[model samples]
Target: KATVDFQPNYDGSQEEPTVLPSAFPNFLVNGGTGIAVGLATNLAPHNLGEVIDGICAQIDNPEITLPELMQLIKGPDFPVSCEIRGIRGIEEYFRTGRGSMRLRGKVEIEENENGKSLIVIREVPYGVNRAVLQERIAELVNEKILTGISGMRDLSDEETRIEIELKRDARPQVVVAQLFKLTSLETSFSVNMLAIHQNRPKQFSLKEAIDAYIEHRRDVIIRRTRFLLGKAEERAELLEAFLLALGHLDDFIKIIRDSKNRDEARERLGSYKFSTATAEKLGILIRSQAAVQGDRYVFSERQVNAILELRLYQLTGMEQDKVKGEYDGILIDIKDLLDILAREVRVLTIIKDELRVIRDKYATPRKCPILAEAGEIAMEDLIANDAMIVTLSHRGYVKRTPASEYRLQGRGGKGLKGMETRATGKDAPDDFIEHLFSVQAHDYLLFFTNTGRVYVERVFELPEGSRTAMGRSIKNVLDLKPEEKIAAMLRLERSTDENGHDNTFREGAGYVFFATRSGKVKKTSLNDFRNYRKAGLTAINLEEGNDLIGVNLTSGEDEIVLVTRDGMSIKFTEGVYKKPQGELAEGEEPVEEDSGEEDSADEEGRPQIRPQGRATAGVTGIRLRKDDYVVGMAIASEETMLLVASENGLGKRTSFSSYRALRRGGLGVKTLNVTDKTGKVVNAVAVTEQDELMLMTSTGQSIRIRVSEIRETGRVAQGVKLLTLKEGEKLQDISLVIPDGEDSPGDDTSVDASEGESGSVTEETTE
Candidate 1:
């Protein structure tokens, strides 16, 4: 009792315990943060089960290596729900006792009803104030350094949810990157594993920290067990005395009855003796050495006093039996306690068993996932690079369906419905697919917007959906201005594992060609867009009111053609060489300079669309008439024919060979005669016989037709009507997907700018 509290109160009247004997490792499980005279401790809290397991593993094998211990201990598991950036910092701290560990708050990207994105914070780094983090982010946004975020709301209650609303032009990835760089969403913990060991302050490695706990536990258990064993032995001795006295109850009663008063009775009972012959005859032996005389036993002073004070009911037969049972139980308990105190291993086992019990009852699994680096996901390597068909709706929804979902349709038939277009409500207009293309799951796509900024997306990163699903919104995925829409999209092949895997046509192998709605064109090397931050960079500088309409990836020597809704079309080359003075453009071969003017029939040709700077608006490819705009652009050989379709479903197939390759910015020849009955030409596509076509009407009706069904005709001929429409319905869009045979994207064929990549011209541009 005197040792229990060694410290005296200020009044010197009371004592308090200075050292607490906690059964668990408080230092490790609870951790600590404090400043000392010359050093400071910034220890991270760990999971109780992990700490206990580490202690037990250590107790089992005292020489366990750090790595073996780490498998069980992992690292500090902060109570807050944030991820540790890597394991290297954990290893450093565990080995040398000091290191810097990075932690990032958890965030989820969600789309709002307004077709905007929200970065919802699921957690904040340990010890960071969510409100302060939000404020810091808001300040950054106000200062214009973090330009993407528009607003913020703190919805944190029991769980943290700091909702940051992104502007229509804000990229979620870029906004998140800015948050990490500028705010407390990401933080570093400087781990200093310092604590008290052996009655002195000391720094400890992982093994040493656990070892200290085990040693303290070992001492505590040993001392506690020793104290319990002493108690049990003392009680058993008294019980033995009581049993011996009960054995000779008649003599003890006689002696007590002969005495007059209690004092005299106690004295006389103390003097009373049982002869050895009598004891042996009674089948009793004394256990207390002080009470045993040479062949006889006499009651001691304390025993005699106990006998005088003993209640009469204790002498009853049932009472005496219960006393015997209790005494026997005590004897067993004493033996066990003695055994435990005798062996050091027994105490260690007891500690381990107790730790395991606590662990079994209180442990929880880790909440935070550890990663190799910030923002890097390791699962991409496991995703198969299967081909997928991606579609974008006019209302900004995007989804990827497997290419196998689409089956080939026979010629001149009503097309199968690929999607059920139920919008948000009845008041909302039904949406139709504006863009459709096929790409490998691992490929990268460059999205050029009407506002001239470019962004990128991995094909696999898109949400996969059923063929009949509505798909996710593009506004929820990419950062775009509210008024800006996708102008042109191009597929760039990038190996997901390029450094480790051998791949042909390294990323950025070709050139990106761009055409504007205002009859302008430009070509830039594809490699220029290979690297960019998530917010993206400017792909082209647009003149006011001159929006980008189309873009394609070219081989730097492909033939380029532009078609207008007014039925005028022109074809040119992308390469630059000497022109024939009057011969502004020519055929597939290199152009030869001619001295004579008006020399029109040159077999040789030069590239027309020169590669321009990334920020430059290009030269004109066609001269548009009033109220006329480019509807489609194609790259094809003169052997193919242009199939022009109008709003009334009237179409014409004109041979490309008949149209002369003129100077890039010329008034193109009429490909079809526009009449009131024929309506205006909506689009034109280069077609081969085996290719298929899909047409949509304003009433949401659609049909499929084969290109071969339309007979080839002269450039100025009015064509046949392909479909009959309802009273108010008109043609809305036209696109196509071909079977895997001749229409398959091969090395030699010209690519359709709309279908994307190096595929045969199978798409009539609607987007």
Candidate 2:
């Protein structure tokens, strides 16, 4: 260690060097952490070879910028193999010596031969204790804050490896995301590149640190060169004196013999004369070419003392030749040393060559992998974008399958098995598929319950399965109150803003029209319930015995049709509201209805009413009998046909023109003839000629028929047999499945039919 300065020991008996002169930048190579009086420092370690290479580069070009130097240095290299996200933090640290970066453990999902997957964490960030990390993860799992982990174990031995076993059917990626959010698997590293330079502590940028190392190496080269030069000059002078005596051997022997003591002999040799050959060589040997000083060889005191102390064994002829050769080599060395002291470029060259050697011997490959773009993975990234067939069973079970599972078949063909497994619930039900439609997984689904509450869930959150697999019960997903069930489900696509946002459309821009089982109807803006809570949000204020049954999205210009179980259907144009209706502006009292303009009916002789707000009980949508309640609701247009089906497998299609437009609170049309031969109306849907219908029975049998094959007739005509049920079976529910990329058929119009008309019915058979 080169002593910068000395300090007394504890008892003042010894001195110690304050700092050692390091050959390389120790602060940057093996980074340090320390806490001083009011400040602290944390520097990340770097690769040894990279540090050496950077020093050499700075020595070659002192004016290089930080960014240019960074190209050679890259970024910090740690011992543990982890991931460092992005270059922004590293660049800032190198430029100003202070910044922070995100570091994540290197993790991979491995699957064994049995198809069981394990989350394996192979490495962690620098300075992180593996035992502490394992403990933290276990604690979170025990607390149930992090889920899907069945068990966790610390398998670290020679290398760090933590294995997290997942339960069967658990989503691995989703669990990993949760782990990152809840545990210390991902963390940040703060960088503070502070060091002592020129006897003072100071912050150093990357380029400045490299420059400091270069200066230290330069000083070492100069001091060493000067010391060697001094020794070489002294040795050269003594060699010249000895060579002169050898050339005049006869005089040298006589002088030594005649002298009384060694001092007298040394004096005699110093004044001895030599031949012209030795004189010429002496002039060239001394740095200054002074003449031989009047035929006498003059030596300094150092050379005289050296000759007096010479041993007898070193006085042989072979030894004399060896001394002559050493003298010549010393002359060359002295000249080169002088050159090094005189030129700064030569010193720099020496520093570069030595650094290169160190780099070649010690450099290693990078351990941390830096990403270009870094941030937390978003929820959208984990969801696959595909058109999925979402099926909701009558028994409250739900699942999603790819749309490719079902192929188009001719009219009246036996439908492909929609759901192959049975669902168990109260009464051991067969769980016929009640609702089946295609929508993208990213879309939002609003589940309107019979209790007038709405629950929102993303399509992707539903359990995904194959066509034959029975899915999880919906009760596990939604927190439904006692005896509550989803009555109607609506799919809301993403709104357009280039970047999609849900329901960004303004209030009153669109409407969600609601219809209840007690023939109550209401219209509320689509944006009114956008901010729903997990438990659910109030969709409408229901009366004591009424429950929500039908919900549809409309632009406020379309026509609506409501059908009852007793074969009654009503069609009305969506009404517009003028005055304040529900929960009036803050503290206003409720106003009594005027009923003044002499209440009158519309052109079709049906009662007309103004629209009301969401909180108010709805106006009458249809007048129903005591034993009847609305069974189906749809938006109708002229080009579309209404497919009505009964419980005993009788079905028919009547053109939407067959229904006449009425005002709100009208129940004045027959959609199908309900009799002993044909049971009560089970389902009714507005469909296009190109669409297909799925008919399900109480016995778990289903059939697909095209809308064009069902003979279209007037609303009063009895329908034909659509499905051949067994002796004890009846139709349970029916759904209209639209093919992809087909425009909805029809123009807005309505037609009315007379009641009590009998018609012939034929039976259609399908295996």
Candidate 3:
């Protein structure tokens, strides 16, 4: 809290007092509360020097208004970055006194070595954080508020980076100036007069308040001046009326000296209105008389002396001087009031001027006539320029062409029919008519007539070798007549592959036709064969057009096969076929023939074929065919079994116990190895109880075994015992048998005897 003493005048006097601890200056103590009371105002403290200067400037030249003061003085100089707002009522407040202050941040700038610059901010306004700033920036980016700034590149604890890629070259200072001028970085303060207050619950309009205050002050001055003037006029009128009523001095004297009361004294002068001289004498007498509470008139010594000394005429002059003094005071007061009113009016005028200047500086007009006119003039200026390409649109359709190129307006001026019609005569025949014209791929084509008639014959052929025309329309060329077509003049350029064969070019055919612009037939040729082939030339179609289809081969004879679309084939031999040969290619190999019934040693020195089968209980022995031989044997339970060898392997073994486990049709026991005369193992054998076996030599040759008969051995063998048969606790020697039979035998033996046990044997049985 601070105290300030204000003395209206520099010289301190008893009458001109000093105001101690003025509430006006101490308004900052409680942060300056303000109340707008109707026309009156209460503006809080501003900077002392600025305020004083502002007031003095206004007083010296009353044209200085509050807004002007604001422009000149601004606000308090705070150490921290701050913004003052809500001061819209400042003019009225200065006139009456009240306003508000809001604080905010200041924007700064920093530059880097890369010639890049960034806007820096040290502090933010009260109640605003870094997040708020970022959010605001993001919102602006989305809304396209901040132009030239692409977006916020990075935002962290210390700083934020905004991406400002300038569209054009701009100086750093110029860019910064633009940022401050157009964007919110520098200033985002708004003066809202609608701040709440205790006394003025609602907002105050400055104009309304100032006008009301001025009117009220004017009325006060007028009323005070009128009252003083009315009093002086009444005094002058009374004295003049009294002078007219008084007749003589002696009559007035009798009334003034002998009257017990003012009413009696007034009656005694009856019908004798005081003459100017008599009224003067009465005025002196009245002046000498002291005012009494009752009927009695008392006179002081000074009054008695004044009565004795008074001349009747002199009294009149004195009375006139008193009236004149009252008029003079009123006049002086009126002049002072007028001066104050003039000062206020001048202040208001200055405020208006300041507002006008501020508005002109900040609130610029939206539309610039110069900018708008530039665009209009540029558009009108478009004409023939070599570098400029023009797109002309008819209806919604547009075509691009060079600035001065000519294009075909359709026959009826409907659509693009041919090239450079403007260069050609419109009366030319359709054959000679070209609807499209170009200079370097800039096509000029007419689409419609002025009468809106569409010319169906209109065609637009894109220039050849145009990369941009890859998927564009080629409908114009394809509509040409058979012989008149450009295709008719096109020859098939044959190419050969690495294999010395010509590339296929069967597209052209007699039935295929190309047309010219006039629908006339152009030249006709075999080049159309390529076109026909691409149109899905089938075998039937190929045959129908046989004269158009030809084959050319460089090497091997190729029979021309015409395959129809439905997969049916027609073959035609065009040249002789030459055979290719080699001995190995014939699949021939040497093999040794077998001698009838010869006992030959296998690769392992043992007989290859084996015979084995089930025998009846009463049958003590069995026989085998010449093709069959003994291999091995086994016994189980009450059954005695024999072993036989065959081309494949050992034979079957059977017992009452074995038969119970496996019926007679099941596999029998057999040996896996065979013995020679020296009792050496020559081969390994495997057999089934179903009379089939496999014989494998030690040398790895294998053959199938089949059983024709089964036999039981009464004793063990003397030379080599092929296998020991076991029955319960007893061991028995089993003899192998070979059967002699007539069987068809000369066939490649890939079949295994074990396959027969599985019911897979294929053989003829004889009785």
Candidate 4:
């Protein structure tokens, strides 16, 4: 034992224990935050049971790896019933003793009495005061920094219940995500492990902290065993003295009666000696010590005092047996305590056993669940990856509804209203749905503007809406230039091959085809658009007074089709191959003409139009007559039928093989017979009978017509009226809904993946 002085007041007090004899390692269970001279510790608390399990595991296997240790102690377990998002911080903190983890309040979406969605906060992040958080939310709502929240109220009692009422048009999922982003509903806990060791402060890793506790536990167990053994042995000796006195009780009583005083009795008793043979004869167990010499047992001053002080009742016949039994029990206790002190493993086993008792009585279930990633609450985490029907209006409003909302309808049926029209305060005409898209929520949405810039985002980023809702302004979603309009969009998983070619879209399509209103066509390597800036990237360079009208993902070898407003259409090969390239990718074949031989070409075949740079003016694919303009372009497939729609709502499906292939830069033959009544050809795409056609008009009306209903006809056939457009409405665009598994680098199709799966992001890196 070491002596130390601690003065809490003017009066001094001295005490010492050398080191504390703790019952268990409480440092990890009840973690602390404190600071001293140049040292501090901000330890996160852990579950008692998990911590004990980990300690036992370490005791069982000192060589356990961090991953294995983590199996027992998953991470810090906060007392609050909130969510702990992501395990990355847990891993970092365990390995390095310094990291952070995200925490979020639990929220539920419910319908109120008025059928409007309401948000309820059930459990908040650790260390956050409910009152303060509610006050903060109230301030934000009052100031209008957080929109869509119409009202809020607190119904807190034993458990938290903060209800936030939403506007009729607010999306519950988006509002919940925004609350996490803007409030203490989401927070983080950081760990920095510092501790006192051997009277000095030290920074510690998780494993180091565990080991230190174990070593301290070892010291405590050993010291306690020594103290216990000493006391047990000391009492066993006193009992031995009592039993020996009982062997000569009458003589001892006579001596005590004859003694002149207590001191005399003690002196006489100390000087007396009993034969060792007497102890054996009486069946008494005696430990030979300083009080015993040679073969005789001479009473020590301590033993004499103990014998003299014994009460008459302890010397009675019935009590003698009790004294003997007590002595025997103490002897066993001494032996056990001695054994415990002798073996380190036994001490550890005892420690483990006691810890189990604590665990069984006090441990609770973990309150926090860990997520897998370390980013903010992403929509990808909440929304399903199912296909959605996204509609865009002429005035730049956009929204996505579940695709199941639209049922199968026959051709020539006037479709239900998909979006409500809203006029601008500046006297701009009321808007109508101009673009209809079928895309998986997780697909990459590339937005190309008439100004030649392109922006990319996930399909789920579009605001979710109910049927007939006009939706949020596109300006709030995308950073667009003045006078810019969304000309086209492609939902493709973008990636580049080792050769820096685009390969994710339609199997092996490695280029992007761009068409302008002036009959200009360009094909640039698709990889060139990878990893664009948030401000967007230049997709195509347009001539003065020209705008981009069509954009399609293309295979370098697919046939290119350009249709003009003046009824001119052309089919030309993207490239010419005299023979197979030195080597081709597996499951791929070289592009060849219709002769069915790799080296042969037919008279109808056309040469491949070489790709052009992004900034350069593309070569003319058609010679448009005065007042004529290119309206649509597509990567045509001979196996698929091409559907062409006109401004006057007339459309026809024709076998792509019916059209003769033409060379680039020419006055191509007419695919649709256009007259004043039929109007100009507006849009065309390669589609199949199983696919559905989404045709939108200039006045924002849309119709979904079954491709099978419109039977294939010969090229140059006069189109039948597909839909009766009201007064001024004319066809503006066409989107083909090919089922999943059909689009690839070679298939030349568009739209949607599997339904009911959450969206995934395709990350592309470029040098």
- Looking at model 1, report the run of 10 residues with the lowest lDDT sum: 758-767
TM-score of each: 0.52, 0.48, 0.20, 0.51
lDDT of 1 by residue, 423-490 (tens): 23335778766676667777777788888989888787787997777888786667665677876677
Lowest summed lDDT window (length 10), candidate 2: 747-756
lDDT order, best first, reads 4, 1, 2, 3
Compared to the true structure, candidate 4 yields what TM-score?
0.51
Residue 364's lDDT within candidate 3 is: 24
Candidate 3 lDDT over 1-767, as tens digits, reads 11222354655553332323221222321123334555332333234444334433543555555555555444434323444333333333433434443443444444445645455455555345556566766665567655545434434355433444432233333444454444444343222333333224444443333233333334444444445545544444443333332323455576578878755654444433323344344442222222321333333333333333445674575665664455456445545544544575643443344434544454322110111010011211112222111121111112333322222111111111122212123453221211111122211222222111111111122223211112212222122211111111111223445875443333222221111111111112223233231111211111111111111111112222221111111121222312223321111121122212233222342322111111101110112223332222122222223332222222222222211121111111222222222122121111234433222222212122333322322111211111211121111111111221223232332333234333221231110
Instruction: Write down the RMSD of candidate 4 (Cα, Å).
Output: 14.4
Q: Is candidate 3 or candidate 4 better by TM-score?
A: 4
lDDT of 1 at 265: 84
lDDT of 1: 0.71
Candidate 4 per-residue C-alpha lDDT over 427-537 given as tens digits, one digit per residue, 9 for 90 to 100: 676776666778887667888887788887677767889767888767556766646788778777535579754445432347888878887777887777666654678
Task: Candidate 3: count the clashes.
Answer: 90
> Worst lDDT window (10 residues) for model 3?
613-622
